[model samples]
Target: MFRTFVSGLILLLPLIITLAVVAWLGQFIIDYVGPSSIVGHALTTIGFSFSASQIVAYVIGLIVFLAVVYLLGLAVESRLRSHLSQFLDSTMRRIPVIGNLYDLIQRFVALMDKNDVEGLKSMSPVWCFFGGLDGAATLALLPTPEPIMVGDKAYHAVLVPSAPLPVGGCLIYVPAEWVQQADVGVDKLVSIYVSMGVTSPLKIPPLPGPGPRKGNLTAT
Candidate 1:
């Protein structure tokens, strides 16, 4: 009987945990969108016009949340998005320490958003040699196609993300020859970083020559 009970309990664990999660989510929704809360009351009021049931009011609140998000996505394509984004950035930047964190998080999120074709596509994975071709080779990301000017010399913007959380990193401006664009996709590179070097390319070609060390990179 003890053995049977243990087996039954083990079998039910998954279902129990799943139910617990669903219950927690439902409570969270009620706490945030229930009639007692400010936003909840507003949503409930909007929902009441369509249905008398309070349950329906909560459902309508979620619908409103999704609708607002959809509208915001559409707004991204409009000219007003620039002004709105600038205003938002300026407002957040006024908060001192947290403001800088917010800005970093925003850029990191933009870099990770694969659906954002223009923003995310511009950043490509590359390998950077710290002191030049002879220095240590580090897998990094190039945020732009063109090189940025550092005095008279041109430098490629290299973002070397830390292991595990690619959220925080140092941006290095390296000379053209120091940066060699990686053949791997952003997703693959991110996986390798997130896995702490556990996941890696099966084979990577050896670093090429100390050919043209001067001037911008010419098309090969």
Candidate 2:
């Protein structure tokens, strides 16, 4: 019975949280945009009670907000809008304190964007080993296979992003031989990190044994 209850809670937790957020948003809109607004006044004049009019106004505001977002999304797809976006971003980056905040927000937004996440995942994923010979492995996105030359030495650039919150992380430069490209998808790696290892794979399939053929070790 305890196990069953736990399973049930796990199944319903996401739905419950989503409903809670929606309810909170509805109440917030009602309090700010519903009461004494034009829509509420119009509804009240049309025979709705004052309280009922406020509720109706809240719904209207939500609908308008969604419609605006849809329209904005359509606008963003245009070439002119794309350039305008770049210009806006550049302008924002010039601000002092706001620049850092904007950069963090931009990274967070890019990480959350489905297309961007998918694209990063589609590129090769790797387990980066840091701290030289004795090192800890970290999941990272392998953006390039070519080693960066610093003086006469070469180093691999690995993107190690934080999990539970994918907004912040570091780009580490490590010895090329220490980085092991993982045979895993971006989604799997993300899930593991976001869940803080709660959703780690039961078994990581064994990497291939020594085999013939294949030239340089290239990215997928």
Query: So what's the TM-score on candidate 2?
Result: 0.51
Name the TM-score of candidate 1.
0.51
Once superposed on the true structure, which residue ranges of model 1 sit more than 4 Å away at CA?
1-107, 207-220
All candidates: CA RMSD (Å):
8.6, 8.9
lDDT of each: 0.76, 0.66
Top candidate, metric lDDT: 1
lDDT of 2 by residue, 79-102 (tens): 666686778889999999999788
Against the true structure, what is each candidate's TM-score? Answer: 0.51, 0.51
Stretch of 10 with least lDDT, candidate 1: 211-220
Off by over 4 Å in 2: 1-71, 77-112, 116-118, 121-123, 131-135, 208-220
Clashing pairs in 2: none
